[model samples]
Target: MAPSNRPIRIAGCSGSASDRRHAMAMLAANCAHDPIDVIIGDWMSEGNMTGRAALKAEAMPAYEPTFLKSLEPALLDIAKHKIKVAVNAGASDTQLLHSVVVKMVRSKNLHLSVAWISGDEVLPAILDAKARKESPFENICTGEVLEEWKFEPLYAQAYLGGLGIAAAFARGADIVICGRVSDASPVIGAAYWWHRWQRSDLDFLANAFVAGHLIECSSYVCGGNFTGFKALESKGWEDIGYPIAEISASGAVVITKNKGSGGEVSVHTCTSQLLYEIQGPWYFNSDVTAILDDVHFEQLSVNRVALRGVRSGLPPLTTKVGITAKGGYQAEMHWFLTGLDILPKARMLQSQILTLLAPHRSRFTKLTFTLNGTAAENATDQPAATVDFRVFAQAPCEEDLSPKRFFRPCFDVIMQGYPGATPHLDYRLGMPKAFYEYYVTLLPQAAVEHRLHSGDGRSLKVDPPRETRVWPRQQPSCAVTENGVRLGGFGRTVKGPLGWVVHARSGDKGSDANVGFWVRFRDEWDWLRTLLSVEAVKGLLGEEYNGKDIDRFELPKANAVHFLLHDHLDRGVSSTSSYDFLGKNVAEFLRSRHVDLPIKLLNRGKI
Candidate 1:
């Protein structure tokens, strides 16, 4: 098929593997009025890959079985429309998923050609590199040496480019299944194939990349996780629709949701997703590096936002690789302190717990006492007066957290604790559970064994991009000046939640947390840009700031300030003991902080 100038419509069906199964059917059912050229689904995540590895270890299918179930409702519509499908639900076993899907398609009497891309599994490659005394597995976030990781790496999956996916579509594939392609690869691949874009189409590729990122989270751009949920209260979120992207030949994309579906697709919703989990203003992909600092959004119509001015550069030579290993066992115990002296009761209990763990403390890799919640003065309800004091312990051996050693100490301390100390009383919730630790590092895109199994018996290799660029890994330093406005002289101040004036979105990247704050009005951006500094953020973080390194990036075009806090999640959600495991609460926490906002900007109404 030759490239066409007409816009290609791609509907985002799934965000993560567990996303609702209705989107695939929703788009297909509404196709007549809202004709879409392709359907894009994303099913891969950093933590899910490790779980898939464990399944492989058990001699079970590593692919997400839920994805297979998801295809059933859309099968007939897919055949009727001849819609091209692409997804990364193959996880650790692309071939197995391919066989299963092919079997399903044949049983349904449909002649849809399915392709599965491989070579995302790079554990053997990492081992071979280690044997050659090469260090390709250094921790990307902390710069820790491989020797320091200690745990044996069971599996490593490198993020592959979209070329393999694009090639699959080129080879008459009705569906493309991928193992560990970047999350945006499906949309980028489908766009590349639809547009017949070459490796040199950097600008087009980058544009598709951002569009994919925005809608890949499905309903997120349709008010799923929007900060302005109050506005969506009347819209009924029970069935918030999934997102869609209409990409033009020039690479500009218009983001919208399923036709007549609930929820929304406003500029704020689009920008909220645009800032999600991104490392910096420059987004790195195996095929292209997107310069997002210049990107802007324009609301074309209700529930329709156009992403514009996303320039591009050469492809990055390196892509992210996730190495998974046994992180050991972790357990937690919680106690409630109600009524008076919450902090004093928490301290007393902490001191007692430390005494109990003093003998076996060295056995634990991590020992933490976290006090959650605060008592309101003259509280009206019992729950309002209560605060939780949690003690978390992690060790290489599960036995270290056994009832006699860990829980017994916890139980014994209850009698000697504060006057109102009471256990949280959930045994299983506090029991030791095994988890995997993820080690991330950048590997050469050329090193990824990109392969395309085009529904034929042969598996063909997809070569690396012909042109690549070596961009600096470091983010540009923050500047105090923004629209030539100084921080102090802007306007009158008020002590209120920063959220009163700012909208924020946050997510996890490896072991770090990234939070993005943006303003509603153009003039507010000037004040926001000047008011928010690394120091200001540190103050806002308060107790959550554990003195870890933070990287700040200014996105003038998006009217956003992005902050990346290193080692914030204690090795990401897979093994973290954090209350907000995914870092989704980071933005909310920051927004809730009391700050001196300019009354001038605050009077414009909250974002």
Candidate 2:
């Protein structure tokens, strides 16, 4: 497997652990029309990894089983085309998944060589830190020392680099399985191996890094979740095409999808993906640090977008490590309030709930009672005149939230209650379920045992980057400066949803939340940059921002404003009693907030 000057074409089939079921089949079926070298999927995340690890002790299949399901339908076509496959889907049990995949291939009489990359499971490293009198590392989101965590630790995994995956491919492995590598490591490894890239190929590696990030979420770059979803209506959404990246030896990339696929690839679609789940202009990776400030996208054709101008720098010595702990148990109850006096009814119901739980309130870790909006005024339909009263409670002990102590008492309220005290028809909502909290922190690459195990019993150790650069606690220079906000400058105004003039995408990073907003026009970008100052954004977030720190950055080329809200999701996904569990709807919520829109921009109509 020698290096070639030919461009390496890689495609993505899965975004998350629960991504579409036919993605692999769709991509593999179109291989005859648009041949690709490798098909990759990014299925590892804080929640997925911790959730899978929690099931290991129960003798459950802990690794991501959905990857096998996705790959099964396309196996024959993939085998016929000789396309390589790589994915970080072997969450916590790579060995088990590797054996399962090998057995599948053997049962089908396929000649694919399967290799697995392990050593990312770093619970031992954390235990050693605790054993040697060393203080636990500070949490990545809040900077609080891990010593403050009271729960018993469950699992820890250090994010691995792509070199091991590259080593596997170099050894002629057709399919590579990984445990907890970074989300983009599969694409990075495929490109690195295809071009015979070296450790010092910073700029080249950076291109692959950005390329991986672009397509790492599969159809996300093909209008799957684009704000311009109306455009996708005509383009077809049911089977939106997955993304493919064509990388030249010099590391330039062109993003495209299969011909006549049920999706459109444009600059806006790519830009939306570029702005998603990213903190600042400088996106870091284990192989190289990519400077996205100058990175730009150009719509080359109907379904092809060219990406370029990605500058690079030395790799970081550390990568993100996720630690999972048994937080406790959580339960939720949904009660609906219909028609008039919604506020008084909500207050009465809440008062009754609090009174009922007062005896065991001390056992509760957190209780979130939300009266989720009022019904429409004199509404036409019965459903429109109904609102949800939700109760989410978490406790360290199961008895605190048991049916008798919790649900039964609350259920008793209906008899002595507010006019229409309707609980969700399903009584199971109040049943306490075990939950795990995930803490993210930086781990030194040297502490990891990154290795590749190929067929024929050969093992290869992939070393860390030769040179590393240290980043400051805050990189203010990496972000663009915001001018003063002048509430009125564009024209005569009208109050409306921000979504009318802007498009947004948001997601979570551990307990922190990341949101990005962009406009369809350059004039709107001017107004957006000045209007969305850090203070303005904090104000827009309203209660969600409640004194939390925020990091704001601008991507001039992408015409977007990005904000990182620290510790906004409480204790990450598992323990947080939040409406937006993973903060995926933060941007949508902000977009729904009313704001003064200039008539001139309003004339352009909603995006």
Candidate 3:
């Protein structure tokens, strides 16, 4: 079939490991709606990758089991409709996943072609680089060199691009399974294959890149975890729809969701997902470097938004490789302190526990004491006024951090503990479990030996596209003016939550956190822009801000300001001791912060 000017519609099925049920729901929804030409599934996460690596070491299957389980119900429909599937559910074992899929298809007597892409695994290459005395693998966020690591890594995998998957489809493969490709690469590959886009088509590639980023998280772009969830309540967020992208030959895109699915797809929702994990204006992927500063979004109608102005250049020489190592064993416990003097009660309990463990302090690699929530004054319910004191400790091995050794001390102090204190009844939290430490560093893309296997004794090698131009490193800059602007003309001002006039979203990138906020009206953009600077963000973060490096960028077309706070999530989601490990609620916390708003803007009801 010749390439046509009509836009290609592609639907995203799963976002991560926990999205299996929703993913199956989306498959049915996709078949009922304007049928999708391609379906993309992103099921791998940083934590999931580490778990899969551990499984592989034990000589077990390392692929995501949910991938086949969820697809089985819709496999017949997908085959009958000829809807191509490209997914990264292969995790650490693409070859095994390929075999399993082929067997399943044969059992069903389906004449579909299956392909698998490999070579993202770079453990041997990393060992070779180390032996050759190549440059040290410094941690991308913390700058800690690899030589300082105390334990050997369990596995290392580089983030691959979409060219391999695109080539698989070019060879007439109906299903493509990939190991460790970037989450958005499946969408990128599908768009490239469907559009027949050339390697040097940077503009088209950038457009597709932005489109993929917006919908890579499935229900996120459909208002699932939005900060302005109160406003979306009328849209029925319980059964939120999965996102879909309609891409034209020119590379322009319209983002929407399944027709009868719940959730709103407005410009606000799109902007929220755009700022999820980005570091700067330049978003680097293996295929291209997308310049996101000028990307614009416009609401065309209900549940439809048009995207434009995305530009791209050649990607950087390096790709990121995630190295997971057995960090140690960790155990945590919580105690509730109720009513008055909660802080003192928590402190007293902590002091007693530390005193009891003082003899064995040397065994611990790290220990933390955290207090969550504050006792409310004049609260009626007992549980409502309680504060949670959490104790988290890590050691070199499970023997040093076992539940029996840790829990006995807490139990011993309970009889003599402070007033109104009670230990949380969850026994599982005290159990020792191994923790995985993640190290992210860069590797040259040229070193990756990517290849596509057609599953029937046929394979082909793939190479990175030739670079057409040099891409510069993005610098930190803000739209803030040196002199403070005047807000006098707006008449009276009211002190209220920033959510009254702006929508915000925040998420984690390893240990760092990114928050983006925007206003609805163009007139409010200038005031909102001027009010929120890097310094303003620091103030909003309060004590959590500390003195870490922060980067700021302005997306004028989207009327938004974005900030990246380095080392803010306290070592990321998997091993973090923070109450909010994923940083999902950071944006909501900032939105709840009180701010001075213009009376006129509030009177106009523009928010």
Greater TM-score among 2 and 3 belongs to 2
Candidate rank order under TM-score: 2, 1, 3
What TM-score, over all chains together, does every model reach?
A: 0.96, 0.97, 0.96
User: Best candidate, lDDT-wise?
Assistant: 1
Q: Model 1, residue 273: what's the lDDT?
A: 94
Residue 484 deviation, candidate 1, in Å?
A: 4.6
Over the stretch 1-607, how does candidate 1's per-residue lDDT look in tens digits? 3346898899999989889987887687678788887888889888798889877867888998888878888988888887888988899998999999999999999989999999888888778877787764678787886776788988889998788888888888888888889988888998898888888889999999999899888899899888998889788777898888999887879999887788888888888999899988889888898988878899999888999889898988878888889989988888988988888888889889888877788889998888888988899999998888888989899988887768778768877778977997788757888888888987777777899998876678999888898888686657344464765776678899999989999999888899889999887787887788888899999978999878888878778888888888888878888999889999999999998888887777776
Off-target runs (Cα >4 Å) in candidate 2 are 1-3, 57-59, 133-135, 477-487
- Residue-level lDDT of model 3, residues 9-35, one tens digit each, is 878888887884546535644675566
Query: Which residue runs does candidate 1 get wrong by more than 4 Å?
Result: 1-4, 482-484
For model 3, what is the alpha-carbon lDDT of residue 462?
81
Residue 212 Cα positional deviation in candidate 1, in Å, after optimal superposition:
0.8
Candidate no. 3 TM-score: 0.96
Off by over 4 Å in 3: 1-4, 20-33, 468-474, 479-484, 604-607
C-alpha lDDT score of every prediction, in listed order = 0.85, 0.85, 0.82
- How many clashes show up in model 3? 0
Model 3 weakest lDDT span, ten residues long: 468-477
Candidate 3 overall Cα lDDT vs. reference? 0.82
